[model samples]
Target chain A: MKLPLLFTDELRGFYKSKLMLILWIGLPIIALLFRFAQTTSTGQDIPFTVISTIVISSLAGTLSSVMLAVSIINEKNRNVYTLFLIRPLKRRELLLAKFLSVYICVTIASLLAVFVGMTTDYITTGMLSTKLIDNTAQSLVTSLSMLAVSCAAGVLIGVASPSVMVGAILVIYGGNQISVIPLMPTILNITYATLFTTTTTLLTCSLLLIAAIGLFERKQF
Target chain B: MSPRNFRNQFVVLREVTKKYGGLTALKKISFEIGEGEIFGYIGPNGAGKTTTMKILVGLLTDFEGEVYIGGFQVPKQKSEVHKLLGYLPQSVGFQEWRTVDHALKTFGKLSGLTETEIEKRITEVLDLLALSEVRHKKIAQLSGGMTQKVGLGQAILHNPKLLILDEPLNGLDPLSRYQFKEVLLKLSKGGTTILFSSHILSDVQDVADRIGIINRGQIKQVGTLNELKEHLAEQRTVEVLLTYATDKWREFQNIKHVKSVEQPSVGRILVNIEKGSDPDDVMNDLAQLIVKQKIRIRGINLLSPSLDDIYQKYVQEGESI
Candidate 1:
């Protein structure tokens, strides 16, 4: 019951933050530019859909993680949560609300990138291939799973570390390194690669959320 | 409120102790605030005032003892207590992006009020705090005094039974301080028991019906202003500004109630008296004696210890230990 209010509040908050703009508008623009440059340089019909999907996935993974980490740490250090904690609100509701809001915003940004990428592919190639469709669809699922894990992991670091710099460093260097593993089986032609990454990511995200909630519940504001 | 009504305690802390690593923040703090009474919690910097407040409001749960509000345990029945209490923290940092009305609305909803109730209370609180003019203004655009006023507004919006305020007057100007006190007076009049912590002695003396002096995480004393004065009233000093220095001032020491008489300056004589002795009687006695001896007199003044003096005395005693 309380989560809904907190979710709406945090969602509205994130929508107004500069991070939203960077993810929703700025990141997609960069992905488009990168795809155009790749096509121009290669002089071969490199599918714009594949390049844009890669860019969005990679950028969303790193940017959403950093965004959630910094937001949680800043709120903690500034005692902003004090106002909410003194009420009937639970600690888990707060952390979970922030996680869901950031995750949802980044997911929307990724979907927008995919739509833009496919339209560009249609305009440049004049047709859509079945292979491109399958790859784009697979990449979307993989990217969603990876982004969820990264955002949750970032929240864990934010709650566990006392300083913002330490949390951000861990998210960028430590978390970023671990998140790349989910994509490995995909390229290696391992059996049920999507299943493997999806299962591992869901498990990791759940563990990270539990760890974050435990830390936040015991935190003194 | 009747004196008997104030005797019924509304809040109690039984040997509450809090420590952080190696540092002891609160050392067995124990006191009670009666219903409808303004209890002022006063102490110096780093004296554990905020810790005590946090414990009462359920913000800090890991502590060493018991706290009961309206007969409900803290941090366990915290939600039940939240319905009855309102808290104003020392330094409130509102989100700069939210407007004043929106921020208050959010707090009102968090306090479990419905939309209509939240609207009504927001209007009432804004009017009470004189913040109606800036209700829609962004928080970042408000001045310091206005910010403090909004902080106070949110605290009393729900009209809670107990209001816990930490350093509520930390940075307010004189006029704002006065207005804040007036709002508190109004709240207390409406049967709201207030526990206000402040480092400003005069402000405490002005509004608090009773005062608790804390130092080094220990409560040195808790009593009404008169009760505290009476505790130290045993020793009173009378200073007389005389027209001329008198070598015969020692002769007046024959009065049985007079403890000692000394002239530390050219035209001033200080007479020390025992407890329960009447200052007016001493002044009259000295006046009669001066007239009988044809002594020239300028003025007679009675100097009793103020609340500031009492606070300093307790703080110094704690420090000396």
Candidate 2:
């Protein structure tokens, strides 16, 4: 009960944040620009759908991670969680709420970007190719999985970093890199992309989120 | 007597001790606050006032003590205790992107109030805290005093039985402070038990039904205002105002039972009397000495110790030890 309430509260907060505004409006624009660039170029083999998925995922995931890390560090420093902790809310719920909200927002933005890119692909080419659809689906799944890992890593950094500067630095330098690890097995073609990515995403995200919750529970504030 | 023996005690701490690494933030402290009573937890900086409040609210779980709030043990039955407790931390910040109404609504909902109850409480809290006009304003746009009021507003939005406020009055202006005190008094009258911590003596003296003086992480004393004042009643002083700027009042120092005499101003002399001496007898001797010395006196009166004196004495004692 409390988790949902806190998650809703955090969702509302993130929904109104400047970062969400940028993601909502900026990501689709970036997708359109990538589609326009691909259409203008001759002999372009890469589909805009696949291109936009990776681009949007990388951009949205990094920005969201930084935003999550900095906000968490700032709120912790400001003792914002004190009021929540004093309520019936658990510390893990607070972290989980933040993770879920940011991940959901980023996922929505990524989907919007990919959808816009796919729509443009269909309008330009006159029909949606099965191969293009298959590639888009694969890229979208991998991107979302990587995003889950990135968001969880962002939460871990937020919980561990002592200050906003340090949190942001860690998220930018080390946190975003976590997204690529799950993608590695797929990139190498060593295993089934969907199975491996989903397994790795669940395992890594759970580990990072559990570590974050442990740190948060032990935190003094 | 043990704090547990108090009738209707809403909060109790028995031998509460907390340490951080090598430094003990709270000693073996003990105190009790009865139902609906305003308990002022007063102390200087780093005196463990915040620590004690945190423990009571179940924020600080690593401590040695027996703490019970509304019959629920702290950190053990914290969830049940949380239902009956409202806490305003010493220094807290809201998500800056939230409007005043949004923040309160979130807190109201998290406190388990129904939607209708949340809306009603939001309206009531905003009006009570004089925040109705700023209901739509973002928290970052509000002034420091307004922000503090918002902090208070959320704490009381659910109307819990016990409220624990740490330095709730730190950033308020004079008018806001007066209004905040009035709100507290009104809440207390409505049967809400409040334990607020502050270094400001006058504020505590004004609102606290019982004051607890904590220093060096120890409960130095806890009693009603008058009871604490009576603790230092024996060490009394007499203030004398002379008709003219003359040093003749200095002669009272030689009178019986007079401990010392010093002229603080040209026409004012403060006489310190012996601890066990009868103040009436000392005043009599001073009056007789004034007449014998042919000094015209305008007024002379015994001075009772103010809260400032009591606070200073206890805090200074804590420092020295």
Candidate 3:
């Protein structure tokens, strides 16, 4: 009950943040720009939906991760969690709420961008084939998995870093690299690409979240 | 442990000691607050007032102590204690994006209040804190005093049995301070036990039924205003006002009971009495000396040490050590 309440509070805060506005409006605009560029260029058979998913995933994932890490660090330094901690709320719930809120928002933004890209593909090419649908679904799954890893790493860096600058730096350098791990099997063309991305997402996200919770529980504030 | 006395005590700390590595923030300090009583925890900066409040609120857990809030041990039974406690931290911050109403609603819901109750309490708290006009305003838009009031509003939104406020009056204007003190007194009258910390002596002297002076992580003294004044009762001074400007009042210093004499103004002299001397005898002696010296006296009054004096004495003593 407390977790959900905190999650709603955090979601409401993130929903109105400038970062959320950028993700919601910026991602779709980027997809449209990609579609226009593809049409103007050589007009080759390009999987716009897959390309948009990858592009949106990278953009939304890094932005959301940086937002999470920086917000948490700023709030910690400002002692914003003092009032919340004094209530009947667990330390782990606070971190989990932040992670879930940012993850859900980024996921929604990613889906919106992918939908825009799919609509452009259908309009330009005038066909929705089985191969295209399969490719889009796989890309969407990989994108979501990558987001999970990035969000978890954001929380970890947020909990561990001392300041917002350090947290943002770590998220860009360390956290972005960690999120790329889920995209490994796809790049290498593994036998079970989907299965491997799913496994890596679960394992890495859980490990990062567990480490974050441990550090947060011991935190004095 | 000593004999358990839970008759009227709502919060109790026995031999509580907390340390950060080799630096001890709190020593073997002990104190108790009665139900519905306002216990003023006063100390200078870095005097462990915040550390003690944090321990009571269950924010700092690793410590050796026996702490009980409404008979529930802290950190061990913090969940149970949390239900009956409301805390406003010294340097607490709110999310700048959140409106005053939104922030209060979040705190209200987290406190397990029903939707209806939260709405009602929000209205009541906002009005009480004079923050109704800023209900829809973002926290970042509020002034320092308004923001501090919002912090107070959330702390009392749930109406817990015990409210622990750490430096709750730090950033308030004079009018806001008066109104805030009125709110505290009203809350106390409504049977809410409050333990507020402040370095402002006059504020504590006005609101606290019993004040605790802490310094160097040690409990220096704890008692009511008069009781603390009595601690320095023997060191009383008398203010003597002369009808005409003259230095003849210095003759009072030659009396046996008179310790020293100094003129604070052109016609007003302050006579310090000896420790064991009777104030009445000293007054009589000064009167006789003034008549003998042909000096006309306008008025004379005995004065006790102010809270400022007592606080400085204790704090300066701690600093010297």
Candidate 4:
């Protein structure tokens, strides 16, 4: 009963937020602009779909990190959670509701941007290549994993930090930077880099979620 | 429901102590609220009124000792207790982006009400609290009074058995405060057990069946207005209205058991009854003296201590508001 109510309420709240609009419409427009700017400078064919996918996935990571962090901190400081906590609601359920709502919204926005980039490329190139598909798919998976880790880290910071500014700083500078740790072996040209990155990212997300839930449960609000 | 439990206790706190870091927020507080009783918790700022309310609402689980609501242990059977509770947190903030109706709907759903039942309750509470006109307006655009009403509305949306309101009238205008008090009284009359906190003595005195005054994280006293005044009966006053004014009323001070006498107005004499003196006996003696003095008498009235006096006397030493 509570999960649906909390989830729907959070979705409505974030969907109408100014930051969500920036992620939804502004990110896609920026990706299209980057694609156009690239064709004029490089002269050689570069897949606009691939470029847009990479740009959007990256934006999702950084944006979701800051957004979820600031949102949770503000809610905590304002004591908005008090209304829910005093009811028959669980601490884990509250955190999970917020996490799932933000995650789903950010995921949809990222995919939309990727779709726009793919459509733009198809329109311009008149053909899609197998290698390009492989590269775009790989980037999509990496971006999503990084985004998940960043979102979880954002929750951890929001729960642990005593102030909103500190939480935001941790999310923007610390969490955004650390989200790339799982992908580090790829730069070193290691074999099975994808497997290593995915496992470590999921484990890190699990730990961060556990920590967030524990802190929230013990928090006095 | 009957107004009395087997032991006449609907809520009980036993040696309930709460501490924050090194500071004790509540020091071995113990009290009982009878079934269907309107229990007012009053204290100065930071006097642990909110802390006690939070513990009762199950929002604070780290406190020592136990609190029972309807014989169920709190924070352990918190979810079960929640079914019977409606809380309006002090200075609570709603999602300002939501309309009043939407906010109520969310809370109603969380309280486990069906859609049809919630809709009916929405209409009932909005009309009851005079919030019908602003039901569709966003909370961000509401006045403080309107927001307070919304908080109250959500609390009562499920018609809870126990209503815990912390400073529900803190920032309301006088008219709104009066209206809120009426709502509380109406709920109490309908068999709801209300535990509300306020610093406004008049508001507490008006609606409370019993009052608890806390100071320095300890409960100073708890009783009905009459009971508290009777407890502090060392000094009492009787006001007498005479047909004519007199400066010679000071002579009556010499009468036995009469501590002092003053003419607050030309024809009104206020006589202070000394401690341990039977006010009835003193009044009988004073009547004979007044008759002998040939003072044309209009009326003699005993004045009870006001709630302000009682609250101040109990909360501090020899302090009067």
Judging by lDDT against the true structure, name the best candidate.
3
lDDT of each candidate versus the true structure? 0.85, 0.88, 0.89, 0.84
Candidate 2 vs candidate 3: the DockQ winner is: 3
The global Cα lDDT (0 to 1) of model 4 is 0.84
Q: Write the per-residue lDDT of candidate 1 for residues A86-131, one digit (tens) a residue.
A: 8887889888988999999999888888888899889877889998
In the order shown, the chain A TM-scores of the predictions are 0.94, 0.94, 0.94, 0.91
TM-score of 4: 0.94
lDDT of 1 by residue, B1-321 (tens): 122248678899989999999999999999999998999999899888999999999989999989999888998899898888988888887765778898888888888889999999999988887789999998879988788788888788778999999999988999889989999999988999999999888999899989899999999999888788878778888887878777767766976688899888887888998778887788788778878877777887888789999999889999999
Q: Of 1 and 4, which scores higher on DockQ?
A: 4
Instruction: State residue A175's C-alpha deviation in candidate 3, in Å.
Output: 0.4
DockQ comparisons of all candidates to the true complex: 0.67, 0.80, 0.81, 0.70
Cα-based TM-score, every candidate: 0.95, 0.94, 0.95, 0.94
Best candidate, DockQ-wise?
3
**Model 4 CA deviation exceeding 4 Å by range:** A18-21, A40-45, B1-7, B241-247, B262-269, B296-299, B318-321
The Cα RMSD across the true interface for model 3 is 0.9
Model 3 alpha-carbon miss at residue B74, Å: 1.2
- Give the true-contact fraction for every prediction, in order: 0.52, 0.85, 0.83, 0.58
- Pairs that collide in candidate 2 are none
In candidate 4, what are the lDDT values of residues B1-321, reduced to their tens digit? 122332368889999999999999999999999878999999888889999999998889999988999888998998889888999989878765788998899888888899999999999999999999999989989998889889999899999989999999989999999999999999988888999999888998888988898887888888887778888777888888988777656767978999889887788999999999899988888888888888787999888888888777776751342
